[model samples]
Target: MIVGGQLVDEPSATSPGTFVSVDNGVPLSATNPAGSGDWTGWSITRSLIDGLPALFARNAATGALY
Candidate 1:
């Protein structure tokens, strides 16, 4: 897999990534399903990781927050 534009050498290893967004006070509603919520589009500017293999965080000190 690829992370940070570099190839991950460990076949049994894992990588983590995140998605972020900012609230603009705009409401996004689903009419058919009757859903309502504000749309906070993904904040790419604040994303630390992007376009990487699927993973999750578990600890802060170790950079994992699962």
Candidate 2:
């Protein structure tokens, strides 16, 4: 998937190579009702935001882009 003209991918539940992956629209936080590390429906991208390289992701379930 793509966000803000940047390229993204949902290759697997957890990152194929590194880091944490949360489910689409599923909140991953200390106080999340669904707990943590349980959601994995996210579209992730490594790109430039505000002219700086950053990692971006979208929550498929909630339409949250961050």
Best by lDDT: 2
lDDT of every predicted structure (CA atoms): 0.26, 0.49
Candidate 2: give the clashing pairs: 22-39, 23-39, 23-40, 23-41, 24-41, 24-61, 25-61, 25-62
What's the C-alpha lDDT at position 26 in model 2? 32
lDDT of 1 at 15: 39
**List of clashing residue pairs for candidate 1:** 20-43, 21-43, 57-65, 57-66, 58-64, 58-65, 58-66, 59-64, 59-65
Model 1: weakest 10-residue lDDT segment is 37-46
Candidate 1 lDDT over 1-66, as tens digits, reads: 223322223322143552222222222331211122211221112233576554432222233232
How close to the true structure is residue 24 of candidate 2, measured as C-alpha lDDT? Answer: 40
